[model samples]
Target: MSSEKKNKMPLGGIINKGGTCEDYDTGGWRKFRPILDKEKCIDCLICWAMCPDSAIIVEDGKMVGFNLDHCKGCGICDVECPDKVKAIAMIDEKVAKKG
Candidate 1:
């Protein structure tokens, strides 16, 4: 690759900028979404911590819900939710919309 072409973009298209994905909706490719059962949630914020997309919506130091626009439906939050305290479930996007 030519030096000119090499510097054109960061490796793997990673940008040095912050909050890069927040400006654009990248969840269109997602196949699933996490549904939160607030009743079961203990305000532990484990989902928030494990979410790679930072899609867990938090307000006032409490987890509110998911930001689907950026969630990418990775299901990390659902998996991270303690098994003993499962408060999140990953659902297919189509089924999620129906219900």
Candidate 2:
């Protein structure tokens, strides 16, 4: 198959450019947001890999936190994390961001 066909999304069509998602901040769109508990985290980077929006921030090959600016509160990271070690939790944005 051609390279383009091989790289095509299963849902079809180029939804957006790759690695440029951060340019558009979707923070206001989130109802719930993923909060990281650094104490409980193992830094396995699972959330980094599972984030569809590339919202997980990494530094020196370790997951430090999420870039809420582009995250849409999808919760894919929380769901993909191992059951026993729930380092990422989705919490109401209002409560989490309370002043």
Candidate 3:
């Protein structure tokens, strides 16, 4: 590709800029969302550490909830949580929103 074309493609050919993830509202792309079982949560913070979208909301060192506007509904949180514990559950977006 030409130099001009290469620059337009983005640095290192990455489709998106690094800092833009926080600026973009990618929640619309989600088909599912994570529902937290507060009672079941052990405060392990696995979900917070593994979340690709950084959607896990922590307040005062506790997992509060998610930022639905920024969460893309990726199930990393659900997957990252211990299998036996299963603190986070992925649910259909429509049902999640209704509840």
Candidate 4:
């Protein structure tokens, strides 16, 4: 009945701070991770534009890597890449960790 208890139902948490989630590393929640093939990449930056988490890393107007700390493995980047290039591939997280 109290305000403190009102937000404590199921899957609940308090928003102590107001800003982006830069402090929270949500990459551990990913079931799959994207791998980029530089050879096939054309640096079109389509992946960077389509990523929901803004996980795509670019430098000097080129795709360089991924910001895994914030990436939730949504696979949007892979889907957004050019079909002819197919530069991004989604690999299972478990398999990727082994290597």
Q: Write the per-residue lDDT of candidate 2 for residues 10-99, one digit (tens) a residue.
A: 465555657665577888899899988888888888888888888899999888898888899999999988888899899998998993
**Whole-model Cα lDDT per candidate?**
0.86, 0.85, 0.86, 0.89
- At residue 8, candidate 4 shows an lDDT of 53
**Candidate 3 lDDT tens digits, 13-58:** 6755467667789999899988899998888898899888888999
Task: Report how far residue 5 has shifted in candidate 2, in Å.
Answer: 40
| lDDT-superior candidate, 1 or 4 | 4
- Which sections of candidate 4 miss by over 4 Å? 1-18
Which lDDT value does model 1 have at 77? 86
lDDT head-to-head 2 vs 3, winner: 3
Q: How close is candidate 1 to the true structure, as a TM-score?
A: 0.78
Q: What is the lDDT of residue 80 in candidate 2?
A: 87
Colliding pairs, model 3 = none
The estimated TM-scores of all candidates read: 0.78, 0.75, 0.76, 0.80
Best by lDDT: 4
User: Model 2 scores what on Cα lDDT?
Assistant: 0.85
Model 4 per-residue lDDT tens digits across residues 40-85: 9999999998888888899999999899898899999889898999
Predict model 3's lDDT versus the native: 0.86
What lDDT tens digits, residue by residue, belong to model 1 across residues 7-75? Answer: 466779777889776799978878998899989988898888888888889999888998888889988
